[model samples]
Target chain A: MTPQPTAASSPRPVLYSFYRSSCAWRVRLALNLKNIPFDTRPINLLAEQNKTPEYKAIQPFGAVPAFLEANSQGPALVESVAILEYLDETRPELPLLPKDPASRAKVRALVEAIAMDIQPIGSMRILKYIGKDKEAEWTSHFLKEGFSALEKMLEKTAGKYSFGDSVTMADLLLVPQFYNGIRFNIDMSAYPIMSRINSELETIPAFQASHPTKQPDCPPELR
Target chain B: MTPQPTAASSPRPVLYSFYRSSCAWRVRLALNLKNIPFDTRPINLLAEQNKTPEYKAIQPFGAVPAFLEANSQGPALVESVAILEYLDETRPELPLLPKDPASRAKVRALVEAIAMDIQPIGSMRILKYIGKDKEAEWTSHFLKEGFSALEKMLEKTAGKYSFGDSVTMADLLLVPQFYNGIRFNIDMSAYPIMSRINSELETIPAFQASHPTKQPDCPPELR
Candidate 1:
């Protein structure tokens, strides 16, 4: 079932996230897509505040997107897919995985290809580690390789979404990758299948709402 | 169902894999754990053979660990998680996910925390791009942070396996990171929880079987 919509007096879920983090953004998109309203607690990575003992208690990894469960099991959690899956399970009305095993596996694989292979190579943390000039080349190389692979996989399974008309967790993944690509200046047209799916994803309120520029923590000037 | 044991005459599953690749190793561990036999078609990352048109056709991104599915409705897929998830689905006797959603999310998150954050930062490919000396520092830094987070998470969820006693997908992920730790000479003792899990994982036939030294593609001297 979909999450209940946030109202004026209701307590919203707390999302410990940063605007630039693709992982955090994925959760935001999932929550939005599922219509779950949450307050954002920006963790400033640049300042290294995430490393403080206080924040470390909340997110040991010092990463953004440690989700605080509204009223259930435990405290906040780290990792995007885990959070998304948690949301999917707790609210089953808008399903993220297919009923069958094969389809679910296919969808999860498509998402991981981007999450594991592509995004990690080009993330800002890695980019900073690589330095400025080489960052573009590094990102371009990964995007080129990853998009090509993604294209072939998408061609095999494309319908209205990454696996069919229904938007599964795969779609939640693709949109963020698309945004990362644009930031790196990789031409989306290079992969037609990705472009088409991305185009379709743009129309959905969940994706549109979760865009980096739209996040509450986004620099007002940048937004 | 767990995959049926292979026979000498059985057509082995074709794995596009590379040595020293955590992602590829995840699948390898799963296959070995399940007692499914497989043949390796090594994708030489150093020579960039994975980028060749022929290889790209099999895996568009040219990432290693693409499984050659002979009878599946969908084409051969890439991504370690997808492959592992697919294996779990097709062979349900040895389930990778917990029956409950919260536990499953915790397990998946543990895997992703390593896969997405820790493993990617020190990727051999990325390291090569950054040069040798600097790569080690970056690798150590990233791994330490990721592992520390994992240690805490594991403490909360530990039993015999990463999540309780069962060897779910999270254990598949842990073994490779341990390998990476060994590669970098990072002290495992730093994280007591991880060391405990590592000790437990090594005893399992599946994890031991899929190690880099056992892979057909590993250099004889290294093996």
Candidate 2:
């Protein structure tokens, strides 16, 4: 039998995402952490599904992780940071941000460092566009530069996770980008704090479930 | 005589920012809009002041727009989005984000499109590293591509500003990136909606005061 909808108040929000997209992984982790039920409609990046006109209608930029909530909404929301904030504001239960404004800002700074500073430089399209010869070198250099700074930032702030013991937006952002770092063979020796935090975060069920390997569209061989 | 601290409850936040830096401008707009008193500590990017050990202590990333809040704080906050959110959360006087979750999401999405997708790619460091020969071409292509998507986004959501009559995070982000587009000579004709919104934003006093030309650190020729 088909299962009933998870949340009774409204239909599950539809998430148009890619299995291995770091940005999409951020939203997936947020959804799982908040216990907010959602349906995933995977847009395969390798297949160029994200570049289609149909996907463009959902996300103007044709990027992964566009979210459409049930009942009423004009169009699917684009940008993973925006989606995470939407869930935090609307759900307000699990609270991806801290109660204190200062602490919340700290969390956001860490998020942007990874999402904006690091991820965009290492994006698949950018790597492809930059040409194949320099892809490994470029990704390695950018990730290392970004991580060196992040390591120092975490040294001052990290506890069990990026912010503290509980997961916030920072942890969600860190995991996916760290996964990318690993994919590029970025040496983790320089980032002990980040390594420790990431190691601890891997044990969390929400993070585990959100791993790219566990996603429906991730390659079977890779899984 | 040197003036006493503006906010009695807490010390006035010291903003470590550069005049032409778009990321720094984002925080400047937020600080001005919120009417939260602040002192600007200019870090000259051209002079490589941001790369100094002194500045690195303030911002581990050695990036401009690190915010140091009053009294007790572990370290100054880096990243403009984080500083903006911190102001909105702590001050909460004039909210940068809307009350509704979806609307807030829309604002954040616009902000990310410029700050993440566009700005990082167009940053001086990245452009210089990309090599001077193709700098203008690469910047133009990236900005135009981003604006094309942003135009569509604004078409659906814009009113007087990016998210209806009042200013939001979208406006703060739009103004600086739009300025950069103009600098690169990216044709704005295709983005009528964005042009209209940006035109309106320029009239606001806070936005005017936060203009790159008005900053103390801006060189006379550039001004």
Candidate 3:
């Protein structure tokens, strides 16, 4: 796909991301999958770098995975799902969404099953704010409940990845959430289809390169 | 836009929705905005209708706002954002997404800021699960935090609605979340831009008709 022309000569897209943020990981995987040439500027969530005014200027929500388009025509896009959609639109070679509207909807529903239904409730900030005592239990319960439904959906959808053989938006969404499930020590044995797809996606270079441990700001111990 | 032909002489799209569910409200508003003919099958979330096997068969997540398309070939869509996108694509007459990719990205970013960042955490299920004691406090904090950023975003994007003069996907997303923020008693005075846009959108017939109180399932006291 030809890069969309911009008014000003644009530099490489810069991704403001945090190493361990699952949301950030989704965009990194998308950039690699689309083979979009880009650079990363790590925002340390632990250090509260994301809350600083400097970072807030890029993303008003102060969230990581803010995508600064090559051309500085508009504000840097926040929301990982939005960034993924933008990349897919601007770089449409390996289409993340299917051609058929219904098929595209199915893929998107699968993505949101994880992104909206599961991830936000289990996010660090939410869990921490709710209380530190039952974080593990809350995370585990929601993950199990979400994965139970996702596993059923994947039973009909998965071939090798979350939706048939190709790597679509669903797969990009799954891997990061799957990582979080592992971090929370959720019982993965119950979700056979998701587990299988996560393993298959792990073999791909795009998925491999975007792993949290491989990111530039990954802590020494984690690396 | 012409409705795509389907086998078995497909019926009008069926929307499984609830009156008070902000997520469902998003899809309801979208269907109205796109002028898609759909029948509502109200699922009483308070009654746990969404948790039954019958509902789960349609949406594995067992969530309100499951959209069963006119055709039966594809699975029912669960996520409101996904359902909105499908409606916009399949019924493209009054385009919900902007023609330009950059403009579309801007609209999508605004949508996700609410759908992903705000709604999930402020959801009834999440608040109930966290504990009833701090529910008000928790909801209030998250809404304030989310709207602060959204207010700033609208400063750059809003004309009459979230992304300019026309009713775009951003507007569809904002109205439902704004409804929730108002329910939580978040001080709306802080978010003047969002408040103004939301009030303007409320005047539109589509938005007015889709309000939770107007839905078939709305209880008399609430209505």
Identify the candidate with maximal DockQ. 2
Q: What does candidate 2's lDDT look like per residue over A1-223, in tens digits?
A: 1121232233778777888899999999999998878888888888889887767766767788888787544477789999999888888998998898878888898999898888999887688778889988888878898999888778767888898888899999999988888989988867888899999999999889989889887889999
For every prediction, compared with the true complex, DockQ reads 0.46, 0.53, 0.52
Q: Per-residue alpha-carbon lDDT of model 2 for B66-92, expressed as tens digits?
A: 887876453677799988888887888
Candidate 1 lDDT, tens digit per residue, B1-223? Answer: 1122232232567777987688899998888877777778788887898878777666666677778654433255677888888888777777888998778888998889888878877776667767876777877887887788888778778898788988989998898888788788788889877788889899877777788888877889998
- Quantify all predictions' global Cα lDDT against the true fold: 0.79, 0.84, 0.84
**Per-candidate clashes, comma-separated:** 8, 0, 0
Worst 10 residues of 1 chain B by lDDT: B1-10
**Model 3 regions lying over 4 Å from their true place:** A1-10, A71-74, B1-10, B71-74
The order by descending TM-score is 3, 2, 1
Question: Lowest summed lDDT over 10 consecutive residues: which window, candidate 3 chain B?
Answer: B1-10
* Model 2 iRMS: 7.9
Error of 1 at B126 (Å): 1.5
Q: Candidate 2, which segments miss by more than 4 Å at Cα?
A: A1-10, A72-74, B1-11, B71-74
RMSD of each: 5.7, 5.3, 4.8
- The positional error of residue A108 in candidate 3, measured at the CA in angstroms, is 0.2
What TM-score does structure 2 among the candidates reach? 0.93
Over 4 Å off, model 1: A1-11, B1-12, B37-49, B70-74
